[model samples]
Target: MEPPSITSHLAPSGEVRDIEKAAHTAAPISDPSVHVPTDTVNDDGLPPLDTSPRGWLAVVGGFACLFVSFGWMTCIGVFQAYYGSHQLSNYSASTVGWIPSTESFLLFLGVPIFGGLFARLGPTVILIIGTILHVGGLLGVASCHTYGQIFATQSVVSAIGTGAIFVAGTTAVGTWFHARRGLALGIVSAGSALGALIGTAVIPVLFDRIGFPWTMRAVALTYFVLLIVAIATTTRRPLPADHPHNPFRISHLAPVSLLGHSPVLILAIACFFYFLGVFIPYNYIVVEAEDAGDGVRSSNNLLVILSATSTVGRVMPGWLGDRYGRFNVTIGFTAFSVVLVLGVWIAAPWRTGRIAFAALYGFGSGTFVSMVPTLIAQVCPDMSKLGLYLGAVYIVIAPSVLIAQPIGGVLVSAGDENSRDRYVWLKVFSALAMTVGVMGFVAARASYQSRVGKGKVV
Candidate 1:
């Protein structure tokens, strides 16, 4: 039997023959006799689907844990402002300011190590322990008499709980959503922003009416309730019994490949600069208002406004990210931040300028935070490794968060011994840092686009 002619397969009646011919034409590009798996078949063979109600329960539970943990972390800015004036005024701004930043760093950086632990132990077990630690840390803070004591209890111990909750909660979310991953993760992450808004507005008002101790006690009570809900609902989905291995092996611990990959590396650098600059506004807004002749009450209200604006910033960008591409959205907002910092913030001479800066920078930076993890998700293929990767990134940037406030404080202290010109220097440096961050984001985006063109899977 003669082999079929290529043109013979072109007839409308020769559908099967045409498929055979097309297959034959492509065969010579590879091994002709070897059977290659179809893309659909390969995808079908992926890890089994999660269908259990328990899996979803775990997801909601995890979100609750996140709401509490991130809420408190975001509220640290409020606490920093409060303690700076009340209990820690005797200490230099640099010294007292380091406490909350350090707490945030530890809270974020400790996640991967704990995430690995959570992977090994059940999330439920980890979350329950974390809840106790979280409440206890806050209670300890309510009882603190000195800056050092507050640092120990609130910064170090509470940070440990925050880390535990973050890793577990984020991993839980990762486990639950695949197709709707970006939207689901966005909603969960929004909890932190919501917490910030609620905490800043509520805590300050509570302090005004009830006193700091009672304010903290109320926060502790709220956390206690949320943690209970978390424990009751949180669980891990059933997967093949592969004795939960640490997501990071010693080999894998050398820094994620994404860091080595130029795109993710640049993004990390951008994050560092973004954090360094953006936090200037967050840390100094209260102080700025006070310097601008606003009273403590008005300063606290500005912080509340920033927090509320940021809550909207966080959610809106996340929704836009789903449509416009995470990288594009991140870069756009980052650039907007740079402009707002320099133009509206640096050039404004009066209270109006300061207030405008707060609103604009608050919204811009909030959008940046909302989009970062989504961008990370786009670059990372394995959902199981999300926590590890995020943790690693935080570990790298932890120093930036640690130093930004103190550095800004030092700048302020140096410019005017009385701290009169600190806000000006803060505005300047913030603008510069954001400019660098935007450049880094642009480089990362270009790198990402290049990789996409190569047909390397995102």
Candidate 2:
């Protein structure tokens, strides 16, 4: 009765009774074999899986998607230079400058919205839609004669499509690898650099012979082929039975929680300034070179060098981040960028130094892009929330692009017709922003270290 008066239920033998008492007082036993560790699983019940052959194939496909999507954006600088001289020559440099900047801004801003869509609709549907919109946007741009048409077709529609495809492709890669996530992401992200290199080398040749419309069409065709490969090869890992639906509820989209987090906030600020500065060189370097009378062919060659150098910089930094720590590597690159902007870009009085600056800035900026996402992954718990967080950051970043390119153009436009004062101002802004960005990045890294102790290791 009454559980035999708890103590009375013990075995008669003293040893057994003592053993039972000790067991009762001891901590609850955990079943090591049965309990899955948090470190071993994604927020989904999926176990930490190795990169499979199929996964590698998917990575290759995803790389192609990234290559086309980002490469196309990088090619915008070249387009801006060309269009500023040709179809849009009638428009002021500052006005025409909005086209590529708007496109880049939209590409960055559109990610979170499309990321949510990707989570719901799945990558296949999103990727297919992206392919159509991307190609269609190019075609639309090719047919357009006015600035409004170019903005509508190229800047808004195409950028949105590229953002969606990029989110899907990168997220797919994220889902497949954990241990190798940084390396995998780096490899895929490098596609943009590769695409830039290819575009820089090829687009100019096409522009000289086939013209902008045909060249874009050729680019569109390349995107189509690459997207088909991505769709066929890429896939999401099977989510666990208990995995939460990644619904884009208004609450999930609320920026307060992530924005309030110091690391994320710092990251957002860093990105804003980083974009503000980085895009200047990208948007104006060709123009500056041309202003210096480098010749159109030489301007194109400078872009090719920047693109090729950037390809290596993007990938190597990712691999280095895996070893040296993401934040550390990122800050290092950002600092280097500031120095290049000030020392190489600003001080350059001749063709050789300007070319050197282009190559240096390209490599440095590429490293920054490749490492930021990896750094973000370290701060966030749920991979599904990556889009929301990244999007929020870009919300700030988008405006920076909107302003930066135009301001650079205005600076250039204000200079004595041949003085290159615009470039001088562009370099000044880039250097200042990069310096601030590096500081922001350092703050972010310190926040990460404070929360999760240094030497503890990721």
Candidate 3:
């Protein structure tokens, strides 16, 4: 049988076939869709997965983890708006921007360490500890009276907790699903959208009715209950104690070695630039609307529309990524975000246009946020080093996140608050940053395709 063609749909058999399939499947370094012929070794080298009830349950756990953890990230605009008018009104926009900026900075900085701990301590323990810190941080924030106090509680403590859950929760999903990894991760990403949709609406109501302190306490309580379910359900497949390639081995402590990989380097740069603008809409659209004289109702409604469309963006792209290709879909939508930022968001002069801008931008940027991680995983050469690679990428991207909103604040602060020109500059900056990021992604995809040859699903 003339050595089964590389593209043959035949049942994969023998070591040679496995090697060929893996080679054909490999696009670059991050996305290793290595196909093992036998139903024994999985792509990541774990034993056969139980993609059944127990396994699916773990995915649910991951969904819950992301929902709770990333709620604040997506709904940060609400907090930004609230602080601007209420507790921290005395502070400058640039100073207020630091709260969310610090949260993101710590979240990225801690991902590697949290990833490492997930392997060592497992998801349950790590999640439990994270839940405590997150809930406590919320309670602390409710009672906080000073800038320093809010910074310590909301920015530092709460952020660290959110980071721990984020790294562990997302990683747990991979343990259960291999072939459907993109879809699974995509569903998990939707949790953030759902959380934002619900949390943003709820926070405003609670603030109006119950006040900030009790509202936070109520939110914390809700998180406590959801976390209990997460702790119960999320789990991973353990490597056999005698397995030669121990993932928990000490030598794997640092992600430094991955810094040398060309794909990793390129993607890291792309991520840094891409993230520079991803959070702008999420953090500033409401404030921008308010400044444009849209009033509180219109501004809040825009956020709701953004959150709803983003949910679709997060879910649909994941399914497409699994069927088509992660990089193809991700790169396409990333470029689309530039158009939304510049064309839609920047041009919105009236309330109706602003609403339209929110929905369109939300959809485009939603995919941008949800699909990038899976794209990184698709290009990763070594499955064992996935966490480390993620860590390295975040390290590059974190500082951009730290400074992006604050810079937007500075831009707006530099000119008249009501001047449409000031906000226009912010949009221009966002669109350009995303455009540069798209080029980087295109370059990486093109470079990989050239090496692999055409007509393959990279």
Candidate 4:
């Protein structure tokens, strides 16, 4: 005979129900989707909501690390401008552009390895190694004068070093806090803007007064001292022995199974498109202005202005995202970026246009950086697996970041000067890429809603 049905014969058709509901009277049904944050538990724990001094210090260390690594990357426009006028003047724009392009790629490229090591070995050992490479690479650039020499030291060597630092800076912060993560990351990301401002404002002045060799030496020395702070302060809370992320089993790094999550796959593709041309304003604003018959040199200060606004962008939006939905705020900011690129960037007169776009776009684009980590947090329930999620996102976006920049350089070459027009194609390309990214975000949210039956976009 078959096993008796868990259900009972009911007096009315309406009384018939799931046997699980009948069992619920004895034991409540458990919801698998309800994730208890690591904060509730001790080992993973996030140090009791991360209000402690050590947690804040980790935030400080993350700021310093990013200031020296990724934040410093924002100033790559100055290098692009300088190379065109100086040592690498012989190379074509697209060819010369490969240096910063590759450097940007390398910064994100090492995340999976670095994230794994960070979870396994803790922040100290990996940070020390990153410090050596980053410091050594910058100092090496001081002696390099030829095309091959600069590319080797700055692009390949220093870039790989910064890549390591970027991972340590971001993931260290990730492991430290849970509830306040968006606010903490936003504060840390402001360091990027501060570094960009210093790099844009200070690097040019240093170049004018001291020349390249000594200028490089000064930057290297500064980075070494700051990196020391990061190594000392950034701390990772231990994950439980059984946690998949505790020792970060290399076998599970960048798990291919994550793509099975509909939201993650859609969002990753969206971010790739978003990043595709987003840096055009940062990397080529100075380059484009410099090529103009009108004094391009006058517009160099715009980068500083952009960085200043970027500081506001990074700090404020992150806090807002915590209060509001991360996805909602991010989508709004991204849409604004599309409007800024298409409307303000392409239409304005030379100097006025550059200034308006720089200030507005800087703030608009800055939110994307700060909010991304928070967005990724939603994809994985376990805070212990944060490193893996971060690695997956970056690895997906890295190749696009690598290629988009060189493509921007090529677009600059395609513009026409005699018509008093340039950067037209570049402007349209950037706007279109952002448009698709916004569409993807919308679709991703729709998918999330379909699965969860959400009322809000979050």
- Each prediction's Cα lDDT score? 0.68, 0.73, 0.75, 0.75
Worst 10-residue lDDT window, candidate 1: 24-33
Candidates 1 and 2 compared: the better one by TM-score is: 2
Q: Clashing residue pairs in candidate 2, if any?
A: none
Worst 10 residues of 2 by lDDT: 24-33
**Poorly placed runs, candidate 2 (over 4 Å):** 1-50, 251-256, 417-422
Residue-level lDDT tens digits of model 4 in 218-241: 999999999988988998655434
Candidate RMSDs in order: 9.7, 10.1, 5.1, 7.8
Report the C-alpha lDDT of model 3 over 168-266, residue by residue, as the tens digit: 777776655556667778888888888889987778888899998999899888888888888999877564343333347553444655556566678
How would the candidate models be sorted by TM-score, starting from the highest?
3, 4, 2, 1
- Note the residue pairs that clash in candidate 4: none
- Relative to the unseen true structure, what is the C-alpha lDDT of residue 119 in candidate 4, on a scale of 0 to 100? 60
lDDT of 2 at 326: 74
TM-score of each: 0.82, 0.87, 0.88, 0.88
Question: How many clashes in each candidate?
Answer: 1, 0, 10, 0
The true-versus-predicted C-alpha distance at residue 183 of model 1, in Å, is 1.9
lDDT of 2 at 437: 81
Top model number, TM-score: 3
